[model samples]
Target: MDWLTFAAFALFAVFSGLGAAFLLRRFGGSSGQWLDALDRLERRIREDLVANREEASKAARGLREEVVGTLKDMAVLQKSTLDGFGAQMGRLTNSLEQRLDAFARQIGDLTKANEMRQEALRATVELRLGQLQEDNAAKLEQMRQTVDEKLQGTLEKRLGESFKLVSERLEQVQKGLGEMQSLANGVGDLKKVLTNVKTRGTWGEVQLGNLLEQILTPDQFMANVACREGSSDRVEYVIRLPGRGEGDGEVWLPIDAKFPREDYERLVEAAERADPEAVEASARALEARIKQSAKDIAGKYVHPPRTTDFAILFLPTEGLYAEVLRRPGLMDALQRDYRVNLCGPTTLGALLNSLQMGFRTLAIQQRSSEVWEILGAVKSEFGKYGEVLDKVQKKLVEASNSIEDISVRRRAIDRKLRGVAALPNDGAKAVLELIEPADVEPD
Candidate 1:
């Protein structure tokens, strides 16, 4: 039997046993057997109570222990979380220190570079002094030769011959020294130029960069670039212009300061007496150099990111600008070699204008797309408004019916009236007669 039913029966037996025992004591030994059976039932009921209590106590204890264990587990989990956070924090700190150290090392490198620049400047000064000495020696030797020629004889020839051998050896020594001095001076000047470039705000270079940036679409090759090709053995501004988009070819444009400043300055000082042939010769040399430069850049810069192109040679200075344009057969030669064209400021400006036009066209196309998208959005919203209008029409019909329903309206009024005060029987009956209930409703 279930414990509840068993308990009920036990209770009844115990009560009966007590009554039988009382009856046995009051009446006769015939009731004494019933009393003994009732006593046995009482003992069995006690056993059931004790067993149920023990089981119930065990379950309660187990539940209480489980609650305590969960609390302890929570405490351990919290500690692990904190430890993991601490480890992460330590790792983050280490990474930050490593980055800081790298920055420090870069700073140190800059400092060393500055020192090397100072040393280079000192070397350049020594080289200039050496050049002055060599020049003075050469002039002295030339004067001595003139004197020997004027008084050519036994003593003179003997002295000149003796001096000539020594002069040749001295010239060789001076030439070697000149080479050493030139190397040193070149390195120093380069260092000074680098320092100036680093500190002088790069205004001229920036202007050139801006010009190129305006001229070329980003996809155009090296229009704003500065780097050396292996063959050129020099670094300068390089550009690549496309050829007539056909027959597998393109054009390269190399631009930099190529005017010989010293010669051009001399020419300006003597404009009336300037030797045109001299200037022309200088121009010829420039053309040769530009041709050389274009050819060199073609090997690397003008190569299709991996192929070749027809190229341009840009001379930023106008001193010899006309000379370059006037080179006979120059254009034909450039074309023959698959490296072509030479552009000056005027042509460069026109190129930039074309690029700007292209960008403007692209921008207009993008705006047209955006306008189409906006129209589509407006059309979609119009459809949503159509759905809202339909829903509003349904609601308006419902409102009309609700207002027409006298029974529903009166029910609401009655509720509101009853909320404020209790209705008297007469008033309540009169109010109730105001409307009739509907005979129909939705099932």
Candidate 2:
């Protein structure tokens, strides 16, 4: 069957062939017997080979069946292990899903609780804010009412004071108006009196007299004098001056007052109306009136040897006097032709002062010789008085010598009596009365 059995059978067959050859050689046999032996041996080898092949085929079949059975058993065991693993995975998956669901529910509850707490806090805060606003509004309204009451009282008091002051001022104004009305009536009466020419003349004369009284002594001037020897015209006033010669009578200086009121009024009216032509005409008329008055005064009063060569025409007001002076060449012409000088109240006062000084000078000159004669007589008497004064001085010197001798004797007596005691007042008086009763008198 295997190589070893085949080799053994081959070796045995060779030996048998050899042995048969030898036997043939020794005992010589037939060829047919060897052939028949060979045939039998070949047949045995074939039977053994057939048995070995059948056993090999059976073993191979048994081994193939055993391998198939072991493979089946292993497959069943692997299927069981896979089924257990699949069941465990399914359980782990379900537990994880349940835990996740519980966590989600807890989170939802916490969120609801937080939202409710926030809503409650918001409502409480809003209620407190509304209460605060209501309290503030009530306080503001009360403050406003208090301020209004104070302002109303203050305004009413101020208005009352203003009305009282205005009423007092009105009363004062009414009183002033009444006084002004009375003054106006007095002015109207004066105007009526001035319209008459005789009354105007008398007023001028009175003003002249007042000025003379104030400035000049009564003996220095005379009123209503007929300065012209042969004329009936009398001047208002004349000042007395010394004559040129010692025996000559006192000289007179005539002063007459004039008022050209109508002409002056016309000029003032024209100036107020701003009419140049009317003003010029009125001024000329005033100038002519003044010249006529000057001529009248000169002709009526001025006389040489009795009065001054020139006379003064007195104007009652400075305004009239100034107007006359303003006329061109008017003052010079009046002085040259009429021998008259223009003067107002102020000018007349100044002229009188100058004349008073002149009178003083004249008086001093007239008494100069008498003053010299008195001085000579006083010189002669003064010499006699000096001789008498010398005799009196000699007598005074002798009296002084005698007084010195008496003082010396009195001191000597005082020394001798120094040791004697003094007497009391009553004892000394009794002793003196007893010694000289006729000489002693009562206290």
Candidate 1 error regions (>4 Å):
1-207, 213-257, 262-271, 305-308, 335-338, 360-375, 382-443
lDDT (tens digit, per residue) of candidate 1 on 236-292: 445444444335354445543333334444444454568786666665665676577
Whole-model lDDT per candidate: 0.64, 0.84
- Provide the lDDT at 187 for model 1: 78
For model 2, the stretches where C-alpha displacement exceeds 4 angstroms are: 1-186, 432-443
In the predicted model 2, the residue pairs found to clash are: none
Q: Write the per-residue lDDT of candidate 2 for residues 27-114, one digit (tens) a residue.
A: 4567777667666666766676567667766876787788888887877877777777777777867777787777778778877887
Q: Tell me how far candidate 1 lies from the true structure as C-alpha RMSD in angstroms.
A: 57.1
Q: Report how far residue 291 has shifted in candidate 2, in Å.
A: 1.2
The stretch of ten residues in a row with the least summed lDDT in candidate 2 is 1-10
RMSD of each: 57.1, 24.9
Error of 1 at 7 (Å): 99
